[model samples]
Target: MQKKSIQNKDSLKRFVDKGINEKELSPFDPPDAYNPLNIETIPYEKMHPFLKELIDEHKNFAEVLSKFETALMNWKNNNWIFNDEIDIGLKQFFNFFDEKVPLHNQKEEKKLFPLLHKKLIEIGEHNSVDSSITGINLMEDEHLKVAQAVAIVFNFLELGSQLPDKRSREITFELAYEQGMAIIETMKLHIFREENILFPQAMKLLSKEKLDDFN
Candidate 1:
């Protein structure tokens, strides 16, 4: 039996490698064997998988935000000077975080939050909804604050690119660092709240029916 298990393990490893060394394999490789969902027939048992995917996407957003913070910090500690290409890339990052992210928040605030609230209420758990409401409101407020900070970064980049004279290099870099710190702090708090409180409470409160509806 142990010999069979060893053979099975070897077979699985070779299947994963397919030819390339493990070090050469990309993260997205061995791509999820596509079992294209028959969405129409999905049962409640499968709803957890769907919600997990949604949560994973939000986690990916947090990672992207962290990367932006790291880049901003590197810029600040050095100098405000940026090549045209780097400036363009930073501007694009701001655009994405500022404009696109809020759309995601809206989906949470409008659709996901209300659904979760209703489920908890039905389960005779008013406290869960109350807590979620508080977190949701706080999260929204922080989102707006972060958006404003991102605008500051955008304006700084734009003005610096055009005139290159309104502020000293140190002053410009300081603004970038300050605004970037504000954005990062807000996001870290928001992510912490959502991950630690909101999401887990939501999964606990939501029934099979509710989960299926969300899906």
Candidate 2:
């Protein structure tokens, strides 16, 4: 049995290597394969997977924001230098908002936020959650505001290429830099509230049945 297990592991490792090391690794999925809904089908002894995914995405956004800021700094240092490299970097930042942020927000609004609200209500602490900041409605409102802010930044970056003069391009980039920083700062505080206050309370209050229902 031990030998068979070892052989199986070796085979799995070989498969992963071939998939990754080869040029055809276009649509790869991880072996441990996390889907938050899987938590419903399994035992709830350690249901940190989904929550961790959400938090990890927040960390990823932080990294993207950092890159955006760095790219802006480079452009500024280069005497209002606008180049293909800087454009690519700024486009990546815009794409992060376009493609990733919405999906991340969906997971929270559709899954985690609802679960948090349910738990708060069940534990008779619904009133304790600040309706202005941390409540589902308030959080959703903030999401909308953030989305609008992101759109403004996206347009600024997008229009930069079409602007006729270098001066116009530089001004647009500067505006984008400020807007992107503000949005990232707001999101950081929002994430802090969720991680420190909301997630802990939900973990304490959430029941096995609720976990099952999430699946």
Cα lDDT tens digits, model 1, 103-195, are: 777767665677765664464433332433333444456667677778887776665556645466466656666766666655664565455
Clashing pairs counted in every model: 0, 0
Best by lDDT: 2
Question: lDDT (CA) for every model shown?
Answer: 0.54, 0.60
How far does residue 112 in candidate 2 sit from its true spot (Å)? 1.8
Q: Write the per-residue lDDT of candidate 2 for residues 97-167, one digit (tens) a residue.
A: 88999999998888778767665455443323232222455467668878997888778877976898989
TM-score of each model, paired residue for residue? 0.62, 0.64
Candidate 2 has what TM-score? 0.64
- Model 2 is weakest, by summed lDDT over 10 consecutive residues, at 7-16
How displaced is residue 208 in candidate 1, in Å?
Answer: 2.3
